[model samples]
Target: MSAAPEVKSADANDRANAISTIVLGFAADPMARWAWSDPSEYLRIMPRFVNAFGGRAFEYGTAYVTEGARAAALWLPPGVEPDEAEMDAIMEESLRPEIAGDIGAIMKGMAEHHPLEPHWYLPLIAADPTWIGQGLGTLLMKHALRRCDEEGIAAYLESSNPRNISLYERHGFKIVGRIQSGSSPVVTPMLRPAS
Candidate 1:
């Protein structure tokens, strides 16, 4: 694989690029596809959905992107998880009310596996679909994992794509639990303890 791209802390100038990168990179993701079913529909609502959940990561936590904004990773510091009311509002507004129950049940089931102890969280990470397997994701993950190690903090995430599980596992994350409610795509929650 080519060397990982240079990693930089995202600035205000990078927010829009970062968000666009997420929507585009995740366009074919299993969970995303499951939620929207139709490609056009998924493209339409993905931004609002990403903004609702991943916006806080940029505002209150940390966001990292490669040169040219080709890839990105959004990390949340301990205690910075989204507010329940805000998330609920976003879902109600951005998603069809029909899928609300399924969404709710999926989230609730996923939450059951979260570690109670303080930890950093990775809600989303993506390379432009064109850049996958070039090691950008690994570089971005190491940048954040280094900080987690410095603070002796654990890290957590729910992997929506089975294909990425091994990549995360290579970084020391272990699958702790799985949630599969109704016809929703499986979400595997993973945790990596402080090294």
Candidate 2:
């Protein structure tokens, strides 16, 4: 396949944009968004996630920075290849009460019960609000999907709201579960096979 546009890899320069994209994505729902609403907190927690997840966390992201103007983004970590049991345990452990109040407790509980293997959660993805409907989200998603597909892997993520769920469905993700965050357990969780 012809290569996609020359997108930039997530780096220090892109951290602010990346963090902003993440916040906006989560901001769709007030409760779940609070976890990382603060930019400084987002930075602190991201590295901790990377350390725990063996880089499955988005210490770096893929972005079509030029055309989309920071529209396309996905915070996915690398290393330790995706594994199911380990991921739930990791996600559950990370969600412990020590992590955050009600949010952590709920996620930790869900992780213990979560059934899936090697699920690669997007955690966050958002095109510039003004840039939606122009395929920027797909552009970024395809980049990661293609990479994961090459490894014959499947992935997963939970959208902050139903509207975004459609965007994910249109992009080939399937609704695997419905997540009602403890503070506000209304968001839907979805999954997709890498393509």
Candidate 3:
């Protein structure tokens, strides 16, 4: 009923919240086929890679209360930084081990190309399934994109649910590629300009 909630800067501990929320958000999508539980899987692995991008990882939430908030969030790692081997280690040691994503090809491609360079990931932008149509995704995305503009960098993400394609388009992302992992479409790569 109210205008959702105010979006604000997230603290250090919010990174885990953001990652876990993303997994939960796509859990039901027939295309996602994601495999992970709430809290434990994401929280345990986030710290290992939170600082991977150096002094640029950020988390923002949309809630009156910080704690216990299913806040929509974004994770924008540093731009122009490269740590190829380090990123490989993060994926092998933490991300894949903790979150059971079926998209081996997606992970493999990420392993090939470094992710630390100028990009934003909407890793956790869910606001309770019941509240989905309330525009929380767009609100969170806008907040993330504004920061990306302030820093003059690009944003990237892969939408598992085809239904969300238009939603992403409205936010300046154009589908760059698509892939099928297993029986369902694994990921749809989208990029938003820094300009």
Candidate 4:
């Protein structure tokens, strides 16, 4: 039997490609839709947000980018989730002042639901818009989950876009909880036990 094609683990050298993939991939995501109501503002602020988000993943945990930047995934390894200060920094750097308070509450709500047990956290994962339905997402998910299995750690993620829940379900994730704060987008938290 042959192994799956490898998705490259991103490093400092892959920063630009990985950031671009994340921004393009998540531009229309539910959270983005709720936060950046203006298309022009979304275009301007999303890249900064993704850069900060993916940059943390790249620096502290595992970041993967498929060939041609079609897909990307950010996984924070067990015990590597960012601290309060880091989260505050991320919000400050990525979000606009007008939307900051609301997004911060959403972030806090999401964080409160995170599993206390050690696990791998997937904060961002996406396939480029042009590459959707082409299996790039599956490739990245499988690759990262395999690593989690090897390390004997559970996997966790919050699906901001309901459309992608089935995709995560297919990869062994089950909804553990749901988060909805006022006007914020509904977030479904999923967990996949270590195999």
The number of the candidate with the highest lDDT is 1
TM-score, each model? 0.92, 0.63, 0.63, 0.86
lDDT of 4 by residue, 140-175 (tens): 998989888998989999999999999999999999
What TM-score, to 2 decimals, does candidate 1 have? 0.92
lDDT of 3 by residue, 1-195 (tens): 745566666656665565455445555655433422345655554444433522134522321112334544545454433244564566576444534354466666543433345676653345556557767677777877887799888887766577888989999999877665554445677778777
Residue pairs with backbone overlap in model 4: none
- Write down the lDDT of every candidate, Cα atoms only: 0.85, 0.55, 0.56, 0.80
lDDT of 4: 0.80
Off by over 4 Å in 3: 1-4, 12-23, 31-68, 79-102, 110-117
Error of 4 at 60 (Å): 4.7
Tens-digit per-residue lDDT, 120-191, candidate 2 = 556556665665676667777777777667877676666656677777887788876654544554556676
Off by over 4 Å in 1: 1-4, 94-98
- Name model 2 segments beyond 4 Å from true: 1-6, 33-69, 77-102, 109-116, 181-183
lDDT of 1 by residue, 1-195 (tens): 866469988888899899899998898899887877777888788777777676777786489999888899889899887556766776676666677788899889877887899999888899889888778889999999999999999999999999999999999999998888777889999999977
The reply for model 4, stretches above 4 Å from the true place, is 1-5, 83-101
Error of 4 at 79 (Å): 1.6
For model 3, what is the C-alpha lDDT against the true structure? 0.56
